[model samples]
Target chain A: MTVRELAALPEFEAVCLPDGEREILGGYAGDLLSWVMGRASEGDAWVTIMSNVNIVAVSTLADPACIVLSEGVAPDGDTLERAKEQGINILTTSLDTFDACVRIASAL
Target chain B: MTDKVNFHFDIDGDNFTSAGEASVRIKKLLREMGFSPDTIRRVSVAMYEGEINMVIHANGGSADVDVYGDRIEIILADKGPGIPDIDLAMQEGYSTAPDNIRSLGFGAGMGLPNMKRYTDDMRIESALGVGTTIYMTVKT
Candidate 1:
């Protein structure tokens, strides 16, 4: 399913920036960068509460289709700007990390 | 014919957030070199795991990547307190990291296993109070 479809699900809250286009499916939730790097797949949706610029770098290396920042966390200004520059879709939601994962999985 | 590329990085032990920088760079380099996406992802993931282990357990280390016509080799060397039991350390959930490290979402004890999972060959040369070296390779 597309990111737009996932965003419309009841469990997911849309904090998407104006420019991001929703695409890809499958949710991988984990804060451990190493594990995620190993397990997360291309076209997978990453649900993380990590709100740092390096998270973007990790996401880039992992090549996830979209990033969902859960637990009411918001990216720093620099992070948001970098996301825009990288053309990476960013979403934020109020649900906790695990709950967000469950929602994304169910949507899948 | 020698078709090889060498890349070197000094991983910073103190910076938690910047731990994966080298892996990211390597990923970009592999992409630019025209590696297949699967090969690039495997190299990046295995290298990232080793980088994290160096930062969190070994107080940082040096990583060297050798890309050749048929395979990619990664060597991570560190002077941290070496692993006592290579067998135990290779387990899925065994970890020596402190509680604080766990809070940062690491210390899951999956580093080595994941490295082995992604790489075609992995060898650990380590000694207590001495140091450790990991050599991993992924075939193209």
Candidate 2:
């Protein structure tokens, strides 16, 4: 599914998408960095509330297909810019992190 | 088709956010070298965990990576208070990191286990108040 599809899903609404070109997600969530680093597969959609540049760094390391920022939270300026620069698809959903993961897992 | 390549990095302990920079660079380098994506991911994840541990526990450390035809080896050397009980420390859900680190989404006691899970081989050597050194390898 494309990012547009994910946004269109009932679980997500555009909180603050500069552009709607981000792609859809494929996988689920894990908060532990090392756990995500070990288990997250490429092209997976990562759901997390981690709001830091390191989140972006870890996303790149994991090569996730997209990142879904849950709980309607917004990323820092540097994080958004870096994500765009890296061509990483990012989205924001009003759902809390747990709910977001459940919705995404069911979707997958 | 990856030819042998060598790389070294100095992990800075003061800055938690910058911890994975070296591992990210290495991941990029391995990709550019045409290593299979799976192999690159394993090597990168394992090394990244080791790097994070260096920063969190050792205060700082040096990492050496050697890419061979069939495997990638990473040696992490740290000068922090060593792990007194390797057996206990190796248990899942065992961590010395503070609550602050956990809030950052790390220090879940998954670091060492994840490193072992992603790598083909791993070893640790340490002495109290001296430091710790971890050796990990991922088969390419």
Candidate 3:
């Protein structure tokens, strides 16, 4: 599903997504930043509770179309600022990681 | 042919929030230089993992990147407590990072292994009391 479509869903909230309206190809879920760095494919929607500035770097390097911060994960001021600077799509959801992924899969 | 372009960065270990800035910069630089997507991704991922390790374990370090016609080389040097057992450290799911670091979504024991997985070549030189230096290469 496109990032625009997913963000429009009530299941998730668009906290700050400059790229939210873009199309996202798929979902890759992992909390370990390094694992996601190695495993996440370009344009995949990364699902994680890690709300850190490094996630911005990982998303940029991995070329994820969007990052879904699951479980209502609240990134710090630094993370939010970096996310904006990097201009990557970031969404937050109260749903757990599994539920978030399921929602994403169905949307796709 | 031109001389290798070099970039140097001082990683800040005091702030977890600032850790991977160097890798991000390198990734951007490579992209601007028109490195292939796979090569840029591999170099950036390996360097970022090493940068995170330096922050979590070595209390920050220095990173140097050299860009050449055939490949990119990354050198990470740190003075933190050295890894006593390289083999064990290289093993997947083996990490010495503290709980606090883990809470930040790192310290999964996947750092080094993932670094190796992405880079074309990787080498680790570490000591018990001194420090560790990692060398990684990603071919263009």
Candidate 4:
């Protein structure tokens, strides 16, 4: 599924969909930025509650299809701006990290 | 070495939010240079981890990227307190970062290992009360 399709789900809300057409091949859930940077594959929907500018940096390096902020967490102002500027897609979900991953996994 | 492309940036220590800016810029440069995705990812990820370490452990540092025909070399240098135990620091899940840093979503002790994992070659040099420098190379 594409990032747009994942955002279209009721549980997920689009925060920034700059690259909605990007394909989502898998899902990775982690708050540790280093671990996510090394482990999250390209085109994976990265799920995390920690929303910061570094998340944007990690996403840029890892090339995740989209960042899914779990448990209704939202990116900080700088992070949102950076994500939009960098052309990184972002989505917010009311579910926790595990549930968000399950939703992304099922969608994939 | 004389003909290779080189880029340098001074990493800022005060702003944790700006830690990885250099890595992001390098990623863009590699993309514009038409590098393979795998090679770009490896270089960018390795550099990013090193950059984060510089900001977290060493106040801040400088990063230099040298791109050759066959490989990319990244040299990160910091003047902050040097690592006393490189072996212990290399162990996963061992971190010296403060609680506030961990709360910022880092400091899980994966930085050095991740840098090694993504690069073809890695090395470290340090002196107590002097500083630390990490050299990493990723073959294209």
Candidate 5:
């Protein structure tokens, strides 16, 4: 499914839809940026609670289709701006990491 | 190889916020040069892990990316404390990064291993209390 389609689901809300047209092929759940970088494949939907500026770099390197900030975590201003600049679609959900993973897995 | 283009960057050891800047820039350059997305991602991830290592353990360093027709060579050098055990360092679950770094979403003991995993070739040269230099290459 495309990022736009995922945003429409009740599982998550599109807080920053920088590239909603990108397609989500799978999902990776991790809080460690390095681990995610090593394991996340291209077009994966990265599910995490990380809300830092480095998330932009990890997303860029991993080329994840989108980033889901679980548990209602909010990114800092700088992170949000950088995410937009890099065309990284970020979604937020009230669900915790585990539930968010389940939701994304089912969606995919 | 004489005609190969080279890009150099000085990684500031003091600022964690500025880490990974070089990798991101290189990703853009490779994209503009029409490299395949997979190759760009490999180079980007390798360089990014090296950059993060320099900031977290080496107090910053210098990175030189040599772009050639068939491959991209990345050499990262730092004057910080060197690695004493290369074998241990290469392990997937070994890290010396402080807790603060872990709090920032790094220091999960995957940096060097990930760098090697993404690059075609990797080498580490270091001297105790002198410095460390990492050599990595990714094929186009």
Candidate 6:
């Protein structure tokens, strides 16, 4: 499924959809930015509770299809702006990281 | 791209929010230069990890990227407290970052290893109480 379709789901809310058309080939759940940066494949839906600006930076380097912020953790103003500026897609959900990953996996 | 292309940035140690700006810009530049995806990813990921380490440990540092015809060289220099034991710091799960850094979703002790994992060659020079300098190369 593409990021736009995933965002359209009831469970996930779109925070920014700059690259919504990108495909989500898989999912990676991790909060450690370095781990995710090294392991998350290109076009994977990265699920994390990290809402810091560094998340945006990681997304840029990793080229994740979109960032799935779990546990209803929303990106702060700076992070949101950076994601938008960098054209990185971002989604938020009330579900925890595991649930968010499950939903994304099922959709994919 | 006949001549060597070079980029330099002084990392701001005080701002965790801006830590990866240099890496991001280098990624874009590599893309614009039409480098292969695999090559770009390796170079960018290595540089990104170096940038993060600089911020978390050395209060900030300088990053230099030199794009040559065959390979890309990344040099990171920091003036913060140097790594006393390079071998220990290079271990995959050994990080000296403070708890506050971990709270920011980093400090998993994977930075140096990840940098090495992505690059074709890596080396480090550090002095106690002086600083650290890392040199990494990724072949295109």
Which ten contiguous residues of candidate 1 chain A have the minimum total lDDT? A13-22
Give a tens-digit lDDT track for model 5, residues A23-81: 99999999999999989989999999889889988898889999999988988888889
Which CAPRI quality tier does the interface of model 3 achieve? high
Which prediction has the highest lDDT against the true structure? 6
The runs of at least 3 residues in candidate 3 whose Cα sits more than 4 Å from the true structure, single-residue gaps closed, are none
Better of 1 and 5 by TM-score: 5
**Tens digit per residue, CA lDDT, model 4, A41-67:** 998899999998889989988999999
Estimate the TM-score of every prediction: 0.85, 0.88, 0.95, 0.97, 0.96, 0.97
Task: Give the Cα lDDT of each candidate.
Answer: 0.83, 0.81, 0.88, 0.91, 0.90, 0.92
Using DockQ as the yardstick, the better of models 1 and 6 is 6
lDDT tens digits, residue span B1-140, model 6: 56888999999999888889898999989999999999999999899899888888888999999999999999999998999889999999998889999999989999999999999899999999999999999988
Candidate 5 global Cα RMSD: 1.3
Residue B12's lDDT in candidate 6: 90
**Candidate 4 lDDT score at position B15:** 88
**By TM-score, how accurate is candidate 6?**
0.97
Cα lDDT of model 2 by residue, A1-108, tens digit: 666667779777643344455454467587777777777877787888776666777887898777788888777787777676656667788899888878877776
Instruction: Report lDDT (Cα) of residue A52, candidate 4.
Output: 82
Enumerate the candidates' DockQ scores in order: 0.60, 0.76, 0.84, 0.89, 0.85, 0.92
- Give me the displacement of residue B22 in model 1, in angstroms: 0.5
Off by over 4 Å in 2: A8-25, A102-108, B1-3
- Candidate 6, what DockQ? 0.92
Between prediction 1 and prediction 5, which has the larger DockQ? 5
> What are the per-residue Cα lDDT tens digits for candidate 2 across B1-140?
47767899999999886788888899889989899988888888888888888888889899999999888999999989999999888888899998888888889898888888888999999999999999999988
The worst-scoring run of ten residues by lDDT in candidate 5 chain B lies at B1-10
- What candidate 4 gets wrong by more than 4 Å, as runs, is none
lDDT of the structure predicted as candidate 6: 0.92
Using lDDT, rank the candidates from best to worst.
6, 4, 5, 3, 1, 2
Candidate 5 positional error at A87, Å: 1.3
3 against 5, candidate with superior lDDT = 5
lDDT of 3: 0.88
